[model samples]
Every structure is written in structure tokens, then in C-alpha cells.
Target: MTRAGTAPAVLLVVVGLACQEIGASFAVLLFPQVGPLGMVMLRLVFSAVILLAIARPSVRGRSRSDWTGVLLFGLVLVVMNGLFYLALERLPLGVTVTIEVLGPLTLSIIASRRASAWLWAGLALGGVAALGGGGWERLDPLGVLFALGAAASWAGYILASARVGRAFAKLDGLALAMAAGALLSLPFGIADAGSALLRLDLIAIGAAVAVLSSTIPYAFELIALRRLPAAAFAILMSLAPATAAIAGFVLLGQHLSWLEVVGIALVIAASIGAVRSSSRAARETAEPLA
Candidate 1:
């Protein structure tokens, strides 16, 4: 009965992630001239506002350690998103995102010994390899560098997120991190976006982008995480690469090969197996009579 109640929220989280990826791809069209840094700044600033209003995280009683976690996570978020936007300039959304997935994939394999973890690794590898196999003819070195940078930052975000999640109940950690991230990106955004940011149409478009790609996704994740274990949550998130692939095809018309499709399936299977294993682990840990 309890599990049934949680299923809908968990599904919504995955869907929310999909929406964010697809929406962001389309949203970029609204700001073709806004440049990468400017768009990132706008999204972060607006997302911070939206999250702040929704989560309203208070720092009154938080410990110093908690603040440190928030700061670390905020820094990671800024770096990851910044580099992602930068890479998008030179690389197709599908390619860059697939590469960035490597970080979380590595993270997923770190703590578990279950056969399912290996399955997930296989999926991760297949998805990544498929991306490589269907090579980009004009692969940009700078683009690859930014994508890898995003990957490293993503790794930081994952570890920091774990700590931040532990530090605060509910969405407090995420809310604070968003706020800090916005502050961190302001200077860069203003410099890159410049006076063009003041245009009404651009501001409106940026706000919509923030709502679709950031605010909605974060809310869904918070709700879903509250209902699921961390391991389960991470496993579910492993699907982002597949989701991004589909999103790319739809919004950007970036066609992926059959190998890419197979690759995505492998990763998704691995993630499911990993989550199922974690669920089993949870059961064993909680129940002694079994």
C-alpha cells in the first residue's frame, strides 16, 4: 500500500526530468543570440527565484556544516550548468549530454556490489559507446572539453547533493543551493548577456525556460525523493541520457542511430536492475525476521 502511493510520484519525477531536457532544447531557440553564459545566468537566476518562493528554506537553525554543504553544492551546480551551456554551443545536445552522463554513471557503480550494479554499468557503457559509435563529423575539441568539464562538475554536484540532502530536511538544501548558484552566476551572465538581457521578449523567454527546466523538475525530484530511497532515486535518474536523446530528436531533429537506441535501452535496463537491487537491500536491512 505504501509503495503504491509512492509510485506515481516517482514516475512523475522521471517525466519531469524528461520535460526539463526537452523544454530546454526548445527554449534555446528563444535565445539564439543570448549566447551560452547569458542563458545560463538567466535560467539560474529565475530558477533560484522560483525555488526560493516555493521551498522558502530558512537558515535560522542550520549548522555551519549545513551551510558548507549548500555552498559546495551551489558551486557545483553553477559549474556544471555553465559548462553544459558552453558545450551546447559547439556540440549537439545529445552528444554533450551523453558524455556528461559518465559522471553519474561512475558514481552509481561506486558503493554497491550487487550484480545489478554491473548491469547498470553495462547500460551506462552501451549508451556512451553508442554515442561515440555514431560519431560527430565535426566534433569540436573545445566542445568536448566543456562537456567533460560538465561531467566533472556533475560528479561534484552528485556528491555535494548527497551531503546537502542529508544536511537539510525537505527541499531546504536545494532551495539554498539554487540561491547561491544564482549569485555565483550573476557576474558572468551579465557580462555575456549584456544589455540584450533587458529586452522584454528575452526576459520572458528566459523565465519560461526557468519554469520548465528548473522549477518544475526540482519540485518533482523533491517529491519523488521524499517517497524513495537515495539509491532508488539515483537509479531512476540514470535514465536522463536516454531522455535527453529522445528530447534531442524531437526538439532539435537530431536523429540518433539504432546503436544509440540500443545503448539507451541498455542503460535504462541497468538502472532498473540497480534500483531493484537497492530496494532488495532496503528490505533486508529493515527486516530481520526475513
Candidate 2:
């Protein structure tokens, strides 16, 4: 895309990332009342409601593969969101996002099939190691595991979402998959939240979380992805850790040390390098033999 086109897309992505972090901060506030699983259920359920209302996806005459793809996509959503929230409950938001991003970073490197991609991988390892600069024991082991699981699930979500997008038009696939995920989480949500879910105020806040974290971001990203190169989009997404940190500090009073900030910066740098390398490799492969 040209510079003019890239500017708007980059703006959209930044807005989406900011909204996402703000939503996550709100979720942390509700963790005391609803627990992380409850927050996940509320977020997914409300997001599904909004998406279904907007998309009104057709249900008739869909193929079996289409249904299967949506189902798997829904499963990925549940795992990704659930693990992410669980990690957030134990770790700071910025750290959680930084670790979770490794899924996409690894995916980009492997897809690039370039030897130089390993250099970025090494940088990312250094970043992760630096995150525990205070001490490895300072970071919760279980939280790190949950973050890792979220990372894997996020990678699955990207692949599954792409397959579902191909199978359905507009936001139809997303709406259907979100509905499936909501239903799948219903029982667990009810169990975890109990009567706390009955509060009208909490319900209202949950709607806001849905809009900020899922609905608006999805819409913005969908539009931006249409105009932006995948590499450029990935580069923009690498800013999530910084956004999360800002949100955490401003909204949740969670502060990070200088070492942790440096760690986040390193991860962001590695992500950008990996994406640029991948894009360059792709372009070289597409060029005509000279």
C-alpha cells in the first residue's frame, strides 16, 4: 500500500490496540467481582449479541465444512480468551501480552523460512529473559504457563479465523463463531459468576468491555486489514505490550520496572524485524526471474 493508505490503516490499528488494552484494564477491575472466567463469559456473550445483531448471518444452506470451521474457530476463541484472562489474573497485563505475542512472532518466523528470522527469535528470547530481571521467582510460574497457552491458542485463532472468513461472507463467520463460543462458555460462566452476574451495573460494564475489546476492535481491524499489508499490520500489533502497560499503569495502577519496560521494547523490536523480514522474503519470491 502507498504511504497515504498505510497512514489510515496504521491509525485504525493503533486505535484498536488502545481500545483493547482499555478493555483489558476494565476486565481486571471486574476480576474481584466476577473472576477471570466470568469476565471471559460476559465479554464473549455480549460481543456475540452485538455481532449477531449487526451481521444477522444467514444460517440456511451452509456446508458441513463451513459449520465445522466455525465450531473450531469458536473453540479457539474460548481457549484464547480464557487463558488470556487467567494469565492476566496472575501477571501484569503488559507482561501477559508480551508473552502471548510470541505465538504470532514464531508463526511469522517459520512462515518466512529465512535464516535471519532466527536472529529476531534470539532477541525475543532475551526480552523474555529480561522480563524476569528482578528474579525468575518474581514471575508466577502458573501465570507464565497460562500466557504460553494463550499464545498457542492465539496462533490457532488466527488460522481458524482465516479459514472461517473464507467460508462465510462479511462478519457472518465471526458472528456465528462468537455465538458458539458464548454458548460453550455459558455453563462455566454461570458457575463462576453465580448471582454476581445478576447485577445490572456489572452487566452494563460487561457490554462496554465487549464493545471495546471485541466489537470495535474487530470492525476496525477488519477494515484496516483490507488496506494494509499483513506485515505492516503485524508491525502495528507489536505495540500491544506498550499499550497494555500504559493501560495497566493508568487504569489499574500496575507499574513495571525499567527492566521490564526494556524487555517489552525488545520484544516489540523483534516482532517488527521478524515481520519486515517475512514481507521482504515474500516479495523476493514473487519477483520475476531477472
Question: TM-scores across all candidates?
Answer: 0.85, 0.97
lDDT of 1 by residue, 181-279 (tens): 999999998888888887998988888888888887877887887787777677778778777877878888877677756666665666566656666
| Winning model by lDDT | 2
Best by TM-score: 2
Native RMSD of candidate 1 (Å):
2.9
Tens digits of per-residue lDDT for model 2, 34-137: 88989999999999999999999999999999999999999899899999999999999999999999998888888788999989999999999999856878
Q: Scored by CA lDDT, what does every candidate get?
A: 0.78, 0.92
Residue 143 displacement (Å), model 1 = 2.6
TM-score attained by model 2: 0.97
Number of clashing pairs, model 1? 0
